[model samples]
Target: MGNLTNAVTIVTSASSGIGAATAKRLAASGARIVLAARNEDKLKGLVSDITEAGGTATHRVTDVTDPDDLKALVGLAEETYGPVDILVNNAGLMLFSKWEDTAVGDWDRMIDTNLRGYLHAIAAVLPSMLERKSGRILNMSSVAGIHVGDGAGVYGATKFFIRGITESLRQEVGVGSGIQVSMVSPGVIDTGWADKVSDAEGRKAANELNKGAIPPEDIADAVAYALDQPTSITVNDVVIHPTN
Candidate 1:
């Protein structure tokens, strides 16, 4: 295990849920955190809390779906702290819907946020990391990607896409670039995502499944464990779920 002392960490989707939890956890480890999300108020409050607790942190209002915003986020992090040492790609959408419902809009939202968002953040940070030849990228995924549940067709597919990219990125950069790529796939973590489902039946099913959901902090712990390792070791994928 290694400490996160002075690590410059950028956590996207950091206004709430897993992203927020991960930011706080990493900051506690002495990492300089840069929080990014579309919500300026939440990001400001989070940064305040971290600094008040004797940690270094800043906030950047960013929309992950926009590549320029992601690039600006990276730039902000570098100016505020230093070059990014860790990137936590946590911005995502999980819109549950049945295949027969033809929830095309939900599908597009998920693809843009879950898939494109991740890629955009990666592109924004990877060049700097590559130049340094040392950095970590942790992608947050879901169990639905591995074992799809009812009414999560498009949402699960997007996660599946994350899984694929995580692996591909790891293969492409992990061996030669000294860049660690990892994935944290959580099962039924209640981030209030169930209540956000737009489809009626899908929302019902999601709420029911969320009954067994774990807290976002659990996944944050997993993220810390994965990142707080010696550069020689890569945690790869951590699949965390409730023991029911």
Candidate 2:
């Protein structure tokens, strides 16, 4: 991995799960981390933990569904650590149910947080990155975006959009700008995301899948790999799954 000593990074949904793990991992690698999430207490706790471990980190309570909050997150990173060398759009929600039984509100929440939220973050940070002519944007997509399943129709749609947008941005940014856009698509993993699964059968199946799921830290490692690559090399997409 290339040196990340002076890189400044912003990681959204960073209070827990994969986002939190990624923040810690990057900080350990010597990046100054700005953690954003809706939960203030958890975010503060994470910052404390990272600092105690000799990693530099700070937190901001951010609701990714709001564009202003996304803008504030990027601005905060700049105020504290200068230009953000990397931005990880990891904030997302997963609500699963059969198409016929799904609630409209749940569908809307998934779309807003999982899809629109990523777009908002990108819009917030793109101009600055363009001006600097160097940056890395990492979007947290999922394997569900690649394979259609019975209960994950809307959720998968959002992730698929992420994949598409990341690729499009990668092309739009071009090689001369030194901006790398990448997406990490992870398989089933152990996380509180299952808390939103209202279907009994879906919950049961998800629990079974998570029994042998990859750790959140594994996905963090994938993020580190993408960010640690030489500035001239871009890892367009990485799909990580548990061996089991």
Candidate 3:
């Protein structure tokens, strides 16, 4: 394993949950962090905390669904900390709904944020990384992508899309370029996401599913491990879940 000393990193959806945890973990490892999320107050607080802890950090209020916002976010990172060495695509939505309910709105939200958002971030960073021929892109995926669960069909589909893109990126860029593409798939992380589900029956199901939840820090550690590697070595994929 290699250490992350002064590695410029960008983490999306860093206001809470896995993104926040991952940002903290990487910052503690001596990485310069640029946090992106829609919550300005929370982003400011997180930046303050990281700075207070002797880590380099900054944030921009961003909506991942917006391509222009992603461009500005990457530009901010570049202006503040030089070239981005790592991009953590973690901004996402997981609204659960049964197919019978036909919650088209929730599905669209999931696709917009979870699917398009990831692509936007990747597009913003990949070009510079390709030019430098060195960088890391870690896509946050879900176990739902591999194994479909009840009431989470569209959410699972987005993750499946993530899996496909991550693999394609790895093969296309990693083989020739010095960039490393990785993915982390977590199951039932306790990110307070279950309580945020809007659908009544979906919320009930989410709550039931979250009973076996693991802390977000667990996934954070996994992400750190995946990234703290030399360029010659590629940590392709890590799947984490609660034993229970």
Candidate 4:
């Protein structure tokens, strides 16, 4: 836990939900957090809230789908605080529709945001992290990545890609580089993500799932745990599921 003190971190999709909660939790533990999201106003508000609470924070409006935007985000963290010691790739989109009914545009958006976006962030930061020989990358996946559900075929595929990519990257980085790559798979979280479901039945089902859903803060605690571990101890995967 003390290892987190004064550590620099970047959390994407940080305007709300799990990303926001994780940013606050890390700040509370003495990490200087950089919040990245598409919403500038929300990012600023979060930064203000953390600062008012006596925790250090900064932010940049970022669209993770854009490689250049990701590069600028890393630059902001470096210039404002220092080199980022941790990167939490938490930004994602969930568009649920049956395989036969899914629109091409929606499918493209899901792949671009959920899969390619993670790749873009990794590419933007890996050079510096590898050069420095130290860093932690925490990718937010989901239980859906493991178990398929109705109307979530494409969304689940995207998350599955995240899991696969993170695992392979972990092996590639290995134990010697001082780089830790971990994946967090949360199940039935209480977030407004259900609003994005196109099918009314899917939306209702998601709402029902939320009846026993874990809070975003629970996942935040998991992220903090991974970040706080000793440099040599890499937690490759963490799954947080609510007990119904």
Candidate 5:
């Protein structure tokens, strides 16, 4: 149970939900946090909370869908706290709609924010990690990635892509490189993501299923567990679901 003291950790979508909770927990464990999300005000609030608790923090307003923004995110981490020791690719969208309904905009947004954004974040930090041979990348997938059902087709595809890349990256990095890659799959966590469901039927279904959903901190705990582990131990493919 090693602490993350002085670790330069970047968390995307850190304004709320799992990202925000994870930032708080990591900051409590003594990690210097770099928060990135679309919400600058929320990011500032988080920075204030962390700093008030005696934890160091910085923030950037980033859109994960943009390569430039992600590059700047990693750049800020480097300039502020040296090379990024860890990256939590947490920014994502879950615009659930029926496949046959032809929600092209929703699908495109998902591809950009969920799939392509994940790639961009990795590409931004990987070179330095490769050069240093020491870093961690933890991508947040969803249980739907492994088990797809109604209203989850496109979203599931994105999570599956994340899982695939996480595995591929871990192996590509090889052993003795000191780089760790992990994936987390959380089921039905309580967050504003549910409201993003545009389809009437899909939104109703999601709302019904999300009843009694687990708190975001539960997923955050899983992230903290992975990051706190030794470099030799990569906590990969964590699946967390509510018992109720």
Candidate 6:
């Protein structure tokens, strides 16, 4: 295992849940952090906590769905710190709906945020990492991506896409350069995962699914583990779930 000292890490959707927890975990390791999310106020709050704890941190109001916004976020990180050593794509929206209900709008939101948003962050950072010849890209997937469950069809699809693409990306970028890629797959977590379930039945089911949910910090630890691995060893996929 390695350490995170002095690495410039950019975490998207950093306002809450896995994103927020991961930012704190990485920051505690002495990594300089850039927190990005749509809620500027919340981002600042987290930044304050990190700084007060003696970790270097900054915030940016970023919507991962916007490619330009992601570009600007990376730009800010570069402008603040020299070059980004780690990029964490943690922004995702979960609005579960049964296919029979055909909630087109919810479907679009999942695709745009969970899938396309991941792509946007990767696109924003891959070039700079390539140029630097060293970096880490950590994509957040979920247990739902590993196994499809009822009432979460499209959401599962997006996670699956993340799992596949992250592995493929690891192969492509981690060849000779010091660059590395990894995926963190977590099961039901208590914070804000089911808040957007619009369909009544789907919403109820989604809530129940989180009954044995683990804390978001658990997943954050998993992300830190991936980043802590020596560059000679690539921590590709990590799956963490409540055993219940």
Worst 10 residues of 2 by lDDT: 201-210
For residue 114, model 3's alpha carbon misses the true position, in angstroms, by 0.8
Between candidates 1 and 6, name the one with more favorable lDDT. Answer: 1
Q: 24-125, model 4: which lDDT tens digit per residue?
A: 999999999999998999999999999999999988889999999999999999999888889999998886666676567778988999998999999988
Per-candidate TM-scores read 0.98, 0.96, 0.98, 0.96, 0.97, 0.97
Off by over 4 Å in 2: none
Reference-based lDDT, each prediction: 0.92, 0.87, 0.94, 0.89, 0.89, 0.89
Q: How many residue pairs clash in each candidate?
A: 0, 0, 0, 0, 0, 0
lDDT of 3 at 60: 96
Clashes in model 2: which pairs?
none
**Any runs in candidate 6 off by more than 4 Å, and if so which?**
none
- Per-residue CA lDDT of model 5 for 1-244, tens digit only, reads 3658889999999999999999999999989999999989999999999999998999999999899999999989999999998999998888777878888888999999998889999999999999999999999999988998688899889888988888889888846678999888999889877788888887887888779788999899999988788876888789997887
The predicted structure with the larger lDDT, 4 or 5, is 5
Off by over 4 Å in 3: none
* RMSD, one per candidate, in order: 1.0, 1.4, 1.0, 1.4, 1.2, 1.2
**Candidate 2 lDDT over residue span 178-202, tens digit each:** 8988889999877877767777766
Score residue 219 of candidate 3 by CA lDDT: 96
Better of 4 and 6 by lDDT: 6
- For model 1 the TM-score comes to 0.98
lDDT of 6 by residue, 23-120 (tens): 99999998999999999889989999999999999988988899999999888998998798999989887777788999999999999999889999
Give the winner by TM-score: 2 or 3.
Answer: 3
- Candidate 5 clashing pairs, residues 3+ apart or interchain: none
Among all windows of 10 consecutive residues in model 5, the one with the lowest summed lDDT is: 169-178
Query: What TM-score does model 6 achieve against the real structure?
Result: 0.97
